[model samples]
Target: MSAATATKTAIPPSGGGLSRESHPLAGTGTLLRFNLRRDRVRLPVWIGALFLGTLSTLSSTVSQYPEAEDRRSAAGSLDSPAGLAMTGPGHYLDDYNYGSMLSHQMLGFMAVLVGLMSVLIVARHTRTEEETGRAELVRATVVGRHAHLTAALVTAALANLALGLLIAVGVGGQGTEGVNWGGSLLYGAVHTMAGLVFAAVAAITVQISQYARGASGMALAVIGVAYALRAAGDVGNGVLSWLSPIGWAQRTYPYVDDRWWPVLLGLALAAVATVVAYRLSTLRDVGGSLRATRLGSPVASAALTRPIGFALRLHRGMLAGFGAGLLLMGVMYGSILGDAEEMIEDVDELREAVEKIGGATIAESFASTVMIVIAVVAAVYVVMATLRPQSEETAGRAEPLLATGLSRTCWVASHLAVAMGGGVAILFLTGLGFGISGAVATGDGGLFLDLLIAPLAYAPALWVTAGITVTLFGWLPRITAVAWIVPVYAFLVGYLGQILDFPDWLNNLSPFGHVAKLPAEAMEWTPALILTALAAALVALGLAGFRRRDLETK
Candidate 1:
């Protein structure tokens, strides 16, 4: 070939059809089988957990308030300050049916979990392989650049499809006569579509980021923004909801409006996102991005000179983000509290229930409820932030830092400080914000004082998560995944206990289960102090382990 022609010639997409002989492309089918084999246990567990949890929740809700009036009373309680604070907008409570409540409380979480699964799986398949050098060997053969991405998405599609079917069966089997099967499928479809769209989104983000963490952060940021937009739209004017993918899914109003059309919209959006990802992939080189990373300092700064400083530097951004989010959530919930009493009038029986639950003014009940929710959400943040160190250790980044003059204790403590301190600050900020707003709307400045006490109630729970993280890092580094299991199990048990009729022993396992739902009820110091002590002991155990163990070899 002429030099000019040779310069312009491109490699065939799959090594010119010698896929297996020349590239991993030929092994796609084999990889598919292998991937399924590898995921057999993990996939089943994840899918089953989601399905069973959802089913249990649905069944419980249906059972708890069988009468329409009872449902209305439950809704009324939600319209209280505590209720609005804990849950989102109060309108969903008006329906007092299984479907509406599930949609309100469960739908967003479902989307988020599904979306996260999609992003993590797809990014692991594509970017993780590239980062670990596995993709290069596969690519050297005849594998298409897009092969891993496609496989990852194919896997997510299968997972989501099964998840959707499970949800349909779970909800439909409840024997709620005239239960909208179509709506259940619509809910599942929207969640599945969200997963697919985000899988594509993660693929595109991985191409743009140099590190898996960066890619994961990008995808998570998208999820956060989408959720925020939806919340803003749902609570406020709702014009902004149109901009969020999550909003589109929720607006499907699966059980309420049972709108089937929006599911199509979500699918269409996912298709477009996939196409865009493919086009973007064509423009980037393997393991590189169109966006370049900026150069670092020529010399190590004071912060970089120590592990604690490094941990702080790495985690501060996320901590700050969580703090801001908490504040805004507080403000939104507080602002809505003023309207709670008014909204409750739509259902007199529900209003009566609110009075019974709080046995006082509706405002008081709501304020108390809001505080509990703030604590719950802040606790979640605590777990996530505390566990950051484990992620670093597992990823091998902690090794270099440990080699540098950092002690194991200091290294672990830095992350713990961020998690515990950040959780306190975030929850406090939320309470403060909500109190201020509630006071303004209700013409009761004392509302601020009342709200202030709420987040403090959560401190013990937050600390527990921090200490658990530390303990896991020291003693069970490989199984630190269990750290999250604590929070997840606690959350499910506490929230679903009344609904699912679980045995007390099962419920007692969650440390958080002991936390008094504060503000709604008077503060109970015993549980709080106990949790705090337990957390401290756990941290000590973790520190002891850390002192004996070798720095992560990685």
Candidate 2:
């Protein structure tokens, strides 16, 4: 039979009901291999970054504080509100060892990122395929129900294990005396287990939702809850923190107590979760969700008719939530700014670090700068939200809409407008909140102007991220993740390099680095305008490319 005919004949039901005689492994092994091949480049990038992060931490720690007293001062800085809120509770930083210092300052973020990578990989491989109907086609051809699911977990597990081992080598290579190789191993173990725990959670979410977006949301919610519970536990009562996966990993106390038991506990929970996920997968139909989305209004709302209106409809909720979050962050960071000045007065090294980021400045200015950094992060969400239209089009959802009466430009522009415009508004509000509160605390109304200006300084970088997404969405649609991933890499370079004492070239990649450090440094319009123009040009190029390309096939 011809390949086209064979492909057509091979598919059983579009909805993916399988026959009893179908072999689970029939098409699965090959698909797994194909997936591995596809992920070869992406996997290496992620794993390499994770290991590099660990190595950077070790090297930077040893270099930054060669003296014992310096290490103590640095450790003491952790008790301050700015440190604890930005990093985490610093209970473990008393030790001068490279491992303990890094574990206290950096490991939580590592664990969070590793888990994030694992969850994204698994969600994309499994739930996404089902959502797109590809899984149904594969499942109809003697592929076992468990094959795709199994492959996702296996792939995530393998990637995470490799990441852990690389981290182990990275930490050991630091050449620190009295280095606890065993403790380092346990450190890697704890992070790897955290990845596994989230991987299992993602698997379970995929089975429950059978859709990528929903699964991603579920996984992120888990991360958010874990962070919140852990933060509360770390700050207030220890009881709530134990409820969070992040707390469990942190409580492992990698360098101080050097406990391996918490990691095993993570493993135990992961195992149970995996088994349950497998059972659910067996019982559920492909592309079927356990929880149903409530039906929308039978008739379209009046506001849904216009492209901009429709875009606003889709993004309004998230924008509101982000705005609220920024306000909350403003209050948290602003309130802590006063406390930070008091707490860090005795710590020279800590003071130096802060001064480097933002010079000897009023606490309100420092708070405004910090809030702006966070607003930079929120810009990423804005870009992702804006790119949704492009993603939908590339995934074939836009095809039918276009086939009807919808124009491609209008639809795409709508999402972009929401992403760009909404981002600025939210950021402005965040700055307002942060600036106003900090000014009130310092009894200086001038702080409000600084706060407002800080977010404006960051606007160019935010638009650049969004513009890149839009540009990519039009051309090379298949690799559109590049738009988001590149900015993220730039962020890593800037943020982590500052922490790890990386070279100047590394920090310069992000436009954020070039933007005037508001309230901390004098404002410069040259770089800001340049970044804004670049971002606008990128969006124009993307739009031009998108207009020329044929509608993507599902």
Candidate 3:
């Protein structure tokens, strides 16, 4: 052959590269299996905890309000603007039966949980793989371009399906009044679709961000906005509600109206998002994002030079978000305080729940309840910040720093300090938020001061949560995720223990259970001091362990 013809034959044709070896979805099954195996323990815990907790809540609601009149009275309590904003639309209050009660009280919030799960799962399997550099290694094999994303979406979908199936079967088989087989199916579908939509949202976000945390943060922000839109819409005309995925699910009205069509909206949104994600994936190479990265300053800032300052810098974004979100929650909870007494007069279940929390009056008791929620939410931040060091270590970022002059204790303590201090600050901010709206509603400026101090009682508990995270990271780094149960369990029991008639032992097990119901009951220093001491001991134990163990380097 001629030299030119030989060279031409040696080069592959344009648009024909690797067509024989790889397709967009090649090796998707292999990746999916690997992702599932990695998540074996994690996914089961999510599914089992949500499944059992949901059923238990339903049964408790049914048992407590057996009579129709009782359910109606409880419904009456939820008919106000505060109820509509917190729960769902006013229509549920019309036919408020056992199933309707679950849909109204649970669906909107449950969608949030399911959506969060989807976002985390997608981000964990997709951008996290890229962030860890594992995707580049895997891509060098026969795996295709879109295999990681496809596998992640599949994993999220399967988990969501399992959760939805369990919920449907459990609720449908219960033989509860107003709950039928069809409505149960629709209920489960709502969860499944909502989760898929968020999973798709995460997929799109992963392509837009190079870091897993950034992608997940962006997706979570969407969840927050969706929830806010739903709340606003539910409180106003039903028009705004239609704009939110959460609202779409809740408006299904599961057993009350059994509007099955809204589930299709979620499915449609998920499909469109997935296609967009796939298209955007081609716009960038592996280990990068669609958006271009900007160059940073050549010199380090004075604050970033110190471990504590750097830790604060790393935590500030989340701190700001949590502060803003919690502040709004406080305002919403406090908005109803002025009318709480009059609205809850006939609702015996609510009256009992208020008494369970305990205060001089219904409004004050409700304020105390808000404090518990704020602390628990703040604990979530505490755990995340405490574990930041572990994530850095595993990612191989901490090894070089440790090899420098930085001691392990100092490095970890910096993050722990941020966690401890930020948690308490957000708690205070949340209280101030409550106080702001509450002061205006009731015309009592003193309420603001009382509210600020109310959250202080739980500061020790937040410290304890951070301590637990530190202990796990130091001694059992592989199992550090178990520390999340502290906040999750505390929030669950603290918020619902009264309504669910949870056993005293169950409630007592939460780190947050013992704090005095402040601004209502007299302040008790015993529990606060004990928790504080316990936190100190745990932190010392963790630091000692970290000093001895070798650093984990991914």
Candidate 4:
């Protein structure tokens, strides 16, 4: 009657699809490509930083301690309980060679970073996708349920392997004294294994929680515990260290023992964890998790109704985590304050560099140097907090809240206030933590006040960092991540500039550079005031821009 529909309809998909269509990992390859594309810049930063850091450290060690006797003296300075807790087992000191020093001192810390990278990579791809509903959209097509997890793991695997190879090539290619090619290969293996183990840990955690942040929090907690266990275990009986993945990585003792079994153990654990994650994935629905979230109160509290209080609630977990983590980190840094003088006494270049960075007394100067590191870390929190509002907007949560009579200015200001206020609190905590530990280690009560006040000087610098994030978020939301450049450059210039022979103007480019090195010199409020004013101007500009622009459609 309609001319037989005029044209034939296209053939429908057959009931029996291709062999791989029904498989659990049908679209994993395609998903992996997407992940790689999405993380191109992010992945390269992680890989390159670790690689370059390792190379520079190795070069620094070689240049700083040339003769065998000098190396022995340097090793003796780091042989204390505090040193062992921070570095690794004292067994590596038996040889006390350059290779051993690099392995013992660097491996433990590097393993933590590698684990973190894997956790973030996996979380970003898997749980973050689910949180944003992208996973559901992609899954609506002919994709398997397990494809996302598989793709995320594959992404992590690629990053870790790339970093491992770089480390191997960097370490071995140098042909430095006391380091062999075989040992260099083992060094890379250590990082590779730790990364895979954490990637699997992330896979399992993502399935355990419905939220991306919760999943990431759990995975990061695992990393913290592993490092703590390694430290305590290394300080105690050697047996305890073996229980931790980080411990296993350290136990490889690249240049000293070069044990291959831990690598195998890591692989076995990765396989087991990955399988468990897959099994659990099958037990849950998309965008849901195995662990149920606790029910909330029916009525909102007085504070919960306000924008400031809501922003605080959203940021509480990160705030607490950063506070605790920084407190512990500050303690570890301070614990080594007692050895700072002895550690640098015999080395001319080293002593000059430390003095150049800080004060008259080596301990005071060392404390001052440590302040920059703490401030850099705190800035990380500032950047993250400042961007929280954008995250809410991108998630479609902010639009609804804004529609309910909350002015955009008030909403944005609330988050910014939290970012700035939280920065102050975190800085205080870190400084206080350093004060307590440094006081204990040196038996000088005055050191406590000196150290505590010293770190606060960087608060203005931190504010500048937050302001940059705000400015970028307002005018250039898509490129907001450029804000990280402020801190990264600060670290490179503030911490390593003297040694690297970086131009003095480069240091001035960072807000941290403008801040007077506290406790080393008297506190200069002029720079602080200038930085504060600059930050305010920047924030205002950003807010103006944000108000004029249309809200991002999510």
Candidate 5:
């Protein structure tokens, strides 16, 4: 052999050999450790929220129903399809106690929270990293092909495990009379399994979509569908419940039957999903997805020539998804209104509680409560939409758009307009859905008009939330993520304040707390007008700040 040829043959290629590449899971531990470090703040926040929320629910249940008679009365009132639909199956209703009551009230919400946590974590590590080109930089090192995916999965699994342990500890600390360690562990385990199942689903979804946004949307869509299915199943027959992870968790009956079988189903499905994700990961190139992206138009339409149109185009899909989910939820709540009214009439205690909460009648109170909850949920979309400008700036897209004669004011306003308009659309659709379903169910066509106007009462409150997000985005761009804490805090105050006996002042910190319970009570104009003025002021302040500050870029 030639000397040059021999020298070249003696040296190994920098990219490594096929044998080395074949072991795609190598270096997963190192990547997992890195991921844990990165997620330290995020994971703890999620776990802490779950822990505190669970503890609050447990303590509230015990305090609210201390006596046996009270417990029995509460359980009897919630035994109907409407109650079961709002809660879960209420498997422990027959032999009810504080622990079971807490479980029925908190399990579904906890499961959903954990599911959301898992989906975001998985998508952040997988598709987001790839989309941002960070994964390529990592892969250029000594990392294995599957190290990124493996690390994401392991991190999510560990997070779920930690959350489960926290929940168990929190439940045990509640020290309810009938609460047992086994039941506490079971409750935590069910939530952990539900989180794992969704994590696996997110893993598989990230593989299917090239873009991080697409992956996130797809995973959240699955969560919405699963929740809707569980709601339908709980309100009707028990068959459809078996198809959802949340349903599976609830069916475990932690404080009652303590069934272990449903957990196996979640585990089995997660395993299959993980295997499928790994297989699919091998089939696609980095930044490529199993689902093909559609080609865009070569020519721009007249609408696309404007900033508002462009903003609307970008936000339309997400707004559509949020609107649809809200509509479905509203319909679900409306469908149960008649049943809720009958149950309230039959149970004097429930009627008293409902009246105390500003319900003129059981139906109106129930509908008003549903509207408030839906409004808060829809406000989440407003926050997200408001933060879109920040996301665009960080992604390096805004700089180019600005270079093309687009002023910062116009650009920011475009996104804000979409956020405000989309928020109103979601609120309206939610009210319309409720109104239509309620009118049909109650045989009162006039119900439609009342319900339609109800959600509008909360619009000013939602605008305040959007304004806060915008203000944060403009002034404190780097820490804009802290804006999410606002909605979470609002949820805690608005939903759990009375149950936790929080002071009125603390509850009033949430804009939703300022909103008058409408349709049940006469609409108060003072708070609404004040909130509107505040929202307007905040938006103006944000615009002024954005105009003065340097544009943030990644």
Candidate 6:
């Protein structure tokens, strides 16, 4: 035989066939490099977002509370159960400085963000590629059995390390007297470890579920439950906190205790989760999951005959999850209104800041500010729902339906209807939760009606965001992922513009910035009506463009 052919046919000394010891992770290095190249844009965006979020909180806290006394007063206000529940633990309250307060405000949120990033990245590389049949092609080459999973984990690890370094540099560079470099390092380390724990969880979940969406759903549910456990523990007894990864991260109290033991717990959990994932991986086939997918109905229902009904069936799970989450957030925010009022009353600087931001009253300002934040979050869902058609088309599912009697407009309109209707339903539910909870806390029956009507003011702004996504999906299907940047920009501008003292025109770029701050100011029909008209125009333009465009598929 030719030398090259003979060499290619050669087997290992121990066996003719490849075994676990010989080839389990044979191509891990190559896969790791490939995975890095694939995620170059994605990793940078995740790291930048986490770093910027941390830095902004630090700068804002320093600027808002320059004096030690102001810091202490603010910390004291947050020591209450309501505040603890809204934020994480109040252990940082004991240290009472800019860094500590900033950590208290940002750590839990940052941890969650990193956790989500890790989970999505890992799942995207593992289950998603496998489901799409890309991993099968790669495995048919010289790749090892564990190479894909190992590469995904390594990539996630490297990304987490980068995030940690960024946090450390950003926190240390603040140069405030309150900045403790050791504590800053600890803060970054805890978040990094939190990411690792969730990455492992996602790996294990992907092994358990056949579909990428199911795996991601399971991981996100774990995160949601972890947050809930931590909140309960912080507001009540501290025992429950030990059960949650987030609670473990928060208990580190970076600037206060600077404890490193909880980090060990995170590391141990990650190790255990990784081992479990590997074991499960060995037990399952390449295209199969550890758990069997449940069987669906053999016969289609009458509702499945229509486009809208099929779209609703596809999106019902996502809509339910989003709706429940918004409702829970509304309840939490509403419960804290009384404490917020007390804090504003006790802190003169805070009161001035609120008034400067156009808060007619402290309560009105707090509620309106929260409404704006919720509206921004709702806009994210709007984009996701609107872009569902693009995802469907790229997945090749839309081609089959289009080959039938289904018109392209009908198909696209079905998804848009869900987007618009679902957005309205979620907003209304959030408002209802907030109003009910606020009424219960304050013993004011009138608040139930007032807050209920306030969220509706921002509905037009939400629709505008959806309309933009639809336009992009129609005209720029190849780069429709760029639509995600709109909500991110809107969030930064709407939430942080006034705090960062950005120019009016810069803030005006966000549609939410144009909506009247409800309850704090009178509802202006002119702006709302104008925004609605603009949204309708955008949707019409998008539909026209879509009609003439060729279908783009993967």
Output the better candidate (1/5) by lDDT: 5
Q: Candidate 6, which ten residues in sequence have the lowest lDDT sum? A: 345-354
How high a TM-score does candidate 4 get? 0.94
Please give, for residues 448-539, the per-residue lDDT of candidate 2 as tens digits: 78776677677788888888888877887777777666557656655554544567876677667777777777889899889989988988
Pick the winner on lDDT between candidates 1 and 2: 2
Better of 2 and 3 by lDDT: 3
lDDT of 5 by residue, 1-554 (tens): 67776554445556665545456877788889989998888898888878887786676667667799988887788888878877888567877887788778778877888999999999999998888778888888778989999899999999999989888878866667878888889888988999999999999999999877779899888887787678778878678888888898888888788898999999999999999999999889888899888898999988899999999999998999999988887787778777776665544544654666775556788676556678778888999999989878876788889888899989999999999989999989988988998888777687788888788888898889888888987888877778787677777666555435467898788888888877888889999999999999999888888988997555
**Can you give the lDDT of residue 296 in candidate 3?**
72
Cα deviation of 393, candidate 3, in Å: 0.6
TM-score of 5: 0.93
The residue pairs in collision within model 4 are: none
lDDT-better candidate, 4 vs 5 = 4
- Give me the overall lDDT of model 6: 0.84
Candidate 3 lDDT tens digits, 23-109: 778899999999999999989988888888789878988887889998888888778788788889888888888999999989988
Model 2 TM-score? 0.87
lDDT of 1 by residue, 1-554 (tens): 67786575656665355534544245566556656786787688888888887876677667666787767766765665444434444556656577777876777777888888888777777777776566777777656666776777787788888888888877866767335787777767777877877777887798888777678778988998887777766666668777877777777776777777767778788888777777787787777765797899899899777666777788776777778878887887778777777765554443554554462457777565445456667877787788777667766777887777777788888888878888888877888888898888788787688776677777888798788777887877776767767667765655444334457788677776676655566778888889989989988898898889876653
Q: Pick the candidate with the highest lDDT.
A: 4
What lDDT tens digits, residue by residue, belong to model 4 across residues 14-69? 78665565677889999999999999899999899999999999998898888999
Reference-based lDDT, residue 8, model 6: 52
Candidate structures ordered by lDDT, highest first:
4, 3, 6, 5, 2, 1
Compared to the true structure, candidate 1 yields what TM-score?
0.82
> What's model 6's TM-score?
0.93
**What's each prediction's clash count?**
14, 1, 0, 0, 0, 0
